[model samples]
Every structure is written in structure tokens, then in C-alpha cells.
Target chain A: MEDVTTLTKIQLDALREVGNIGSGNAASALAQFLNRKIDMAVPTATILDFKDIPTILGGPSTLVMGIFLKVLGEISGRFLLLIPAQTSIKLLRTLIPGCEIDDPLNMGEMESSCMREVGNILAGAFLNALSALTQTPMLNSLPSMTYDMAGAMIDNVIAEMTAVSDKVLMIETSFIESEEDLKIHIFLLPEPKSLMLLLHKIGVN
Target chain B: MSVVIPVGMGELKVARSPETLVVYGIGSCIIVSLYDTKSKVGGIAHIMLPDSSGIAKERLNPNKFADTAIPALYDAIKGESGVFKANLHAKIIGGSEMFPPTEDYENNIGRDNTAAVKIALKKMGFPLIAEDTGGKRGRSIEFVLESGLIMLSILGEEPREL
Candidate 1:
């Protein structure tokens, strides 16, 4: 059994570098779509244990949109983008300038559509970066949205990944531009039987 | 007058007035709504986790988790200027998987939360009036104060009243 604690460090550096590249691409995409200057900062990367997710993100509450993807033939994972409710509303208003939404509690169809598009752009950029780094083809699943009670969200992801792979690697990144704060969490879970194959391909084992 | 009692995770709110009680973003958590038409009173609780024992000692705020929150909800509704027993009605929504690939933790939390709620409600002598639970989606629930109608919106699903 590999030490899960230490295992994250080995890939942490590489994931951070990838995040830098991915953020740049995503910023460009958003800027082009919104027709405005979108300033984004490359976030410091960290590895979060399943237990610490809630505290790391602020509270035991989260709103997430995730997309699953199969990459490098042997590795399968998901790209998750998260924002707190306050930040989501702020970002949405910015993205949809001149739209007046009175109730912050109400999420109308237009807001949902905008969020979905944002999900698509972020997922596309992140996956493209992964493909380039690994020199592998990637296939994507439709994006889905959810709000979770903090730690439960990460716990669910770990539990689900364990069924397919004994170990799961999580890469964490954040985005902040002006007043918007967005966090992106990525996971790479290789099926148990395919673990060795992936390790060999990455020259890790 | 409409009194909007916002039930945060693991918290419950009850009002005697004909006011709407709402709980937002009930993702994997469960929202329990009880109403008494005769008394013209209603309440809602949003429970986050299945058990309070597993939570930190400081988080014992009944409004933050399922196990602790349900009991608090009962006390709030039944203890004070609450409703008469004969006029009470109940409904529940939200308790969804939300995440598919992570069936163990993500999916099970919703189920566990619902079970805990049912057990608590049964023990409290409150029968379920209606329920919309279980799926791979999140929901927002509102309990109409005057009519005691529960309105829910689930992702990709039509908005409905129970």
C-alpha cells in the first residue's frame, strides 16, 4: 500500500504547474466570451485530505459543478469548479451585466445557463491542459451541478473514486480576480487493475 | 404577514404566523417541513449530516446537522406557541445523491440523512405528510405559510408543490 499522505506531494508540483497553464487559458476564454477584461490570478496549490475540505473552503457548505473525463487511456477523473453562494452571485452579475436580479436566493434559468457555460469553458480548458501535459487524448462527460454540506462533498467524491481505484489523487487550485473567488478541485483515480499500467506509463513505478 | 425563517444546515425554524419558511440549497442534506392547518402554524428544518456524535463538540448547534437538528426542530414546533397536534401535517424534500461517481460517501449521505429524519420524526409522533427525496440532484424547498404547501425545485426537474 502506498502512503496516501506522501503520495500527494510527488504529483503536487506537477499539478500546480498545470493549474497555472489551465488558469491562463480559462481567463482568456472568459475574457473573449464576456468581451471584458478578466483578470485571474494563478492560485497556490495544495493537497486537501477528504476530512479537511470543508474548513479549507470556508465552511461545511459548498456549491460545485463537476465534469468527468477519461484521459491517457488509463486514468479517469473529474474536474470540479466551486464557488460560495455570495461569490457565485457576484460573478454571475458581472458575467451578465445590466441584468437586475432582486433576490439573491432565487436562481433563475438565465443564471443557471450562464453557470453551465462557465462550467463548460473551465472544464474544456483544464482538460486541454491535461491532455497536453500527458500527451494523451481526453474524453469528457456532461457537466453536473450540486450544492453540498461542506465535507460531505469531498467525502462523496473519495468514496465514489475508491470503488474504481484504491487510491485517488486530488489537486486543488483557486481563482481570484477582483472580488470573485473560485476554487477548482481535480481528481485522478485509476482503476485498481489499471494502476500499475498508469504508473508505468508515467514512469512512477 | 410573511415570516421567512431561513433554516441553515442542521437548523430548524417554526412560525405560527401565515408566513413562508424556506431552506435553500438542500444538497445532500434533508429538509423536513411540518404544518398544522388548523393552528395555522408551520416549520422547516434543514439537517446537514446524519449523526451529531461524529461532529465536533462545538458544532452541536441543532441547526447544523440532521441528528441534532431534528430534535431541536421538534422542540421548537411543539414546545411553545406552536400548533395543536390534530392540525399538524408534514412533508420533506432534498436528500439527494448530488454526486454519482462517489456513491459511497456522496450518495449514502442523502440516504442516511433521510433515514435519520424518518426515525426522529416517527419517534416524535409526527407522521410524514409528503416527501420528495433521493436522486442525483440538489434542491431548494419552500413551505408556504398560509396553505402549508411545500414547493421544491430540483435540478433538471420541474418545480412542484407537495
Candidate 2:
């Protein structure tokens, strides 16, 4: 794998373009689901080297929504959605309208269903975009959900990816939908040799 | 008067009045509550890990680990209002398996935290009155001081008395 510092400019541009398309597709799908106009804006993509994940995420408090996609015969990573606790609750309420929670909140079937559907939609859209850009057939695994302290989440993701691939590249993006801003982080993990193959395909290295 | 004691990570709070002791955002952490009806006193400890013996030996705060926090909670309630008894009722919440993969590291923390609390309570001769735990979600718990009632709320579930 090339030094992460060297690929910043190129990777950032590629990721931003990819995010723009993916976010657009997701917004359309969500809008249809809600039967209302869902405005989504994709901000510039930020590159987070695996080592700097904690710093990029700020404090140890983070709500993560991760999506895993298999692209180019390799299982790459994508953080299709991420938000703070405060934002997550608000988004949950927005997605499931009129869901009233009492003092001691317990998640019921309706709320779980809503979150799962949202994860599926976001992961589907993002994977589709990634496949089209890479000119490779991509398949996505079932979406899994979890929440944790930011540091623990980042550490777990990195550790898990490293066990599978030699190097992992992450693409980070921010989105504003229905006046709610959220973070979307996508990870691309390729074995060293596979990464070289991908770069050759893209005419990069 | 209803006083609200918000317990953070590695912290414990005790109240004697008809107050509510709560802990929020309990992801992969344990929230243990000890209530004594005779004195109308309750104590809560929000612990992050199962045991303190392995990691960060220097940062040994009794309230930070289930092993130590459980004992500290008992002592605090006893010392504060003479409510410590082996038969004190206990209710626990917020040990959620909030990770996607079953074998993943993130998933183990909650399990470990829950196991530690259970062990500690058993060793101290305390019986668990009620519990709501082990799910892929977050929880907020409130211990009503007057009635020693434990109420648990998960993200999408209805609030129920434990």
C-alpha cells in the first residue's frame, strides 16, 4: 500500500465525487419513502487515514452507522452513516413520525424496523455508486447496526478490517437532509496486491 | 422533593429522598441499582468494564469497574443511611450488545459488563429483583426513590417498570 499521506489529494477528489452521487441517490429513495421532498447536500469529502480515526471523530462519544460492501472481489468498508447521539435521536424521530417515547425509553418493533430499513437504503445506494465508479460488480452484506463510544467504535472497525485486508482507506462525507446534518464515512479495504490491481485499473499507480 | 442523580461512567450516586437516579447512553456499560425499602434509600453505579484487575492498574477507582463498584455501592448506601443489607433488592439495566457481529470486540464489552455485575451481586449475597438488559440498543434507567421502583427505557421500546 502506498503511504496514506501521498494519496490524500487524489483519494479526496474521488471520494467526494462518489459521495455526491451516492447521497443524491439515497435522498431520492428516502424522499419516496416519506412521500415528501428530502433535501440532501453532500459536503466535501475528508480523508481519514486509519491511524487518525479517533482524532477525525473528535471525542469518544459517537453514534456510528456502518455499511459493508464487497467490491472488486474484495470486501471493502463504508461508513454510510454516522451521527452524534443528539442528532441520532432527532433523526430517529423524523424517520418514524409520531413515535412517542416515555421517560424510560425502550426500543420497540416499529423503531427497530425503521432503523433497519434506513440502514438498508443507505447501504444499497452507497454500494451501487461505489460499484459504478469502480466499474466492478459489488455485492453488499446484510447491514448490521451498533452504537459505542467513539474510540471503541473506531478501534473495533480498524482491528476488524486489518484482520481481513492489509490496508484500509476511508472516505468521509457530511450530509444535510431535512435540515438535519449527518456524517457518512466509507471505508475501502484492499489487500496490498489487490490495491495495486485497483490502482492499475484506475490508472493511478 | 425529587432529586435527580445523573450517574456518569465510573461513578456512583446515592439518594435517600423520593428522587430519581438515572444514567443515560449506557452502551456496552452496566448500570446497577441497589434499593432498600426500609430506609427508602437507593444507590446506583454506572461501571464501564467488568474488572479493573487487568487494565490500567493505576486508575483504580472503585466506582469504575463492576468488581469494585458493586462493593462501593453497598458501602455507600450503608454508610450514608445505614441501608446496606445482603438482602437489599437489586435491579440492573443498560448492558446492551450494541454491535453487529456476534464475535466482534464491540459486542463483548456489554456481555462482560453484565457478567461482572452478576458475579459481584451474587458474591455479595444480593438477589436480583428485576433486570432489563442485553440488546442491540441504548437504555435510560430511572430509580424512583419513594417506591424503589426501577423503570427502564430503550431507544424504540416502551418504558416499563423493572
Candidate 3:
């Protein structure tokens, strides 16, 4: 019945290192894909109570676009890349020039598929890095896109995690592209057991 | 004085007349709201999972699962206002499959949650009066205690009363 909030300083530092490695790989991948300079903040890994999750990502009612992928293999979990609606449109514009970014909900199937691919590429980059660092084999499912309230989307992640623990372990990193005025967040929610496996691998109890 | 009571995950609350009960960030999770029109008293449970069986809990968190939450809601409404179970009506909302399924991940938890909530309510003999469930969008719900009116709002969409 240990909550994620009780992680000792050493554990937090270890997790932050993992976050840095994973997001570092992801940022480079995105930068290459967009063909632009991308800057990322220092990654943070922390355990938070379930109820506080909604408020952390700009409150419960904030509208956002989420790209989700399920990670499978040695370490199973979920990965998410979330951007504001405006950021998503800008991303679309950058990815497919002349493609209409207006109407976040209404988009061609081809455009939607492009977004999905963007998710796959970004999620793959982070998972690959984590997999390499932990020496754990990991694979991801095809990416899926949804536009909704950020709180509601996070509820799905929390619901999946509840079977194992009431606490959620989150690795969050924010990145920005100066050319497009785009700001996006990358999140990793490793299963509680898988997280322990990671901590054990890193020599933390 | 009318107070806005916020119901977070795995939580439930009861409010009297003129007070409002609200639950936010309901995606795939179900919100079961019970109200008694005569007494102007109501309760809302934010249920995260469908079933509670096989889980070890040192303390019973009734609001965390549909199976336990509905009966708890029935008792709370009845105990606080002397309202009969028959007089109570249920409105369910926020079981949205927020994302499409991938090759390996089948995102059907929203349907599972709605079904479980239906079964739980049926077993408790509480009739369901309204529901807004099963979509790709997330929803927020507001229940007014004065008239038992439920307001459902999807982001970027106009709010509707049910």
C-alpha cells in the first residue's frame, strides 16, 4: 500500500535520470522529423496522487490533443504525447504544408494518419531509449489520436494504473519549437511493477 | 448558501438543495449520480473501475468501483433524506473511449464501465432516467440539487441539460 508520493530523494533522482535519457532521445527524433531546432526542458519523474493528475496538465477542462501508444514487452506501460489544439494544428502545418490546420475535429483521414505516425515516431524514440538504458525489450502498439479534455484523457491512464496501485508514476518532459510556436509534452506511465523492475535495474530499492 | 462540491476520482459526495455537485475529467470512468426530487438531495460517485472483486483494500473505498459505489449511493441518498430507493433516479455519464484501438491495445474500458454501471443499478433496483455515454470525447457533469437537473458539457461543445 505504498503510495508513489513517498519516493526517497535517491529514487527521484534515479527516475529523473531515466526521464532525461528517454526524452533526450525523443526530442532528437522530433527535431529531425520536423527539420527544425527543438529545445526540451529537463525531464522530471515523480509519483503523484491520482486526484491531482488533472490539475497538473492545465486543469480538468483544458482542451488538448493526445496521441497514445501502449508499450509491450519486458516492461509494459503507456506512452502519451499531448499538445494543445493550436500546437497540433501548427504541427500538422509543419508536417504537411498547405494542409488545413483549421477545425481540429474535422480532418482528412490522411491527415489523421499523419498525426498517428507522428505519435508512433515520438513514442518509439522514447521507448527505444528507455529500453536500451534498462536493457529491457519493449514494443509499442500503433498510435491513436484523440482530441478532448486533458483531464478525461488522463483518467483513462489512471484507470489502467489503478489495478496495480492508487499512485501514478509519471515521467514528464516539455519541448518547444521556436519556428512553429509549438509546445508539447511527452509522458511515460510505466506499470508499477515494471517501474520497480526499472528501479531494481538502476540499483535503487 | 449554495456550494459547489467537486467529486474527484474514487470519491463521492452528497449535497442538499441549492448546492451543486460536479465531477470533472470523466473519460472512460463512469459517474453515477442519484437524486431524489422530493427532498432535493443527491449523491454522485466517480467510479474508476467496473468491479472491485479480487482487489485488496484495507479500507473499503466504495466510490472506486461501480459494484460497490451504486449501493453506497443508494444508502447515502436514503439515509440522509429518508428517500425511498424507488423515488431515487439515476443519471450516468462520462464513459467515453477516449482513444481508438491500436493493433495490441483495445480501448473498450468505457463500454465496460457503462455496462457495469448499468448492471449495478439494475441489481439495486434503481431506475436509470438519463445517460450520456460512449463517445470519443471527454465530458464534465454538473448536478443541481434544487431541481435534479444534470448539465453535461463536452469540451468546445455547448453544454446540455438532461
The numbered model that scores best in TM-score is 3
Q: For every candidate, what is the interface RMSD in angstroms?
A: 8.4, 7.8, 1.8
Q: What would the TM-scores of all predictions be?
A: 0.53, 0.54, 0.94
User: lDDT scores for all predictions?
Assistant: 0.60, 0.62, 0.85
Instruction: Output the worst ten-in-a-row residue range by lDDT, candidate 1 chain A.
Output: A158-167
* Candidate 3 CA-lDDT value: 0.85
If you score just chain A, what TM-score does every candidate get? 0.71, 0.71, 0.93
Superposed by TM-score, candidate 2 places the C-alpha of residue A122 at a distance from the truth, in angstroms, of 9.8
Q: Could you give candidate 1's per-residue lDDT for residues A77-158 as a string of tens digits?
A: 5556665566566657778978666433466778766776777777677667656666666655555555444443544344
Give the DockQ (C-alpha) for candidate 2: 0.07
User: DockQ scores for all the models shown?
Assistant: 0.08, 0.07, 0.70
Stretches of model 3 off by over 4 angstroms after superposition: A1-6, B104-107, B155-158
Model 2 chain A, TM-score vs. native? 0.71
lDDT of 1: 0.60
Tens-place lDDT per residue, model 2, A1-205, is 5333345577556545666676677666766765656665554654343445545666434444433323325534434355555545655676776966432135576765666667677667766765676687666555555554454344334433332222346645444455445434444344334545545455555
Question: B19-92 in candidate 1: lDDT tens per residue?
Answer: 77776555566788777777777778766666666444652455545556666776677765646766666677
Grade the docking of candidate 1: incorrect
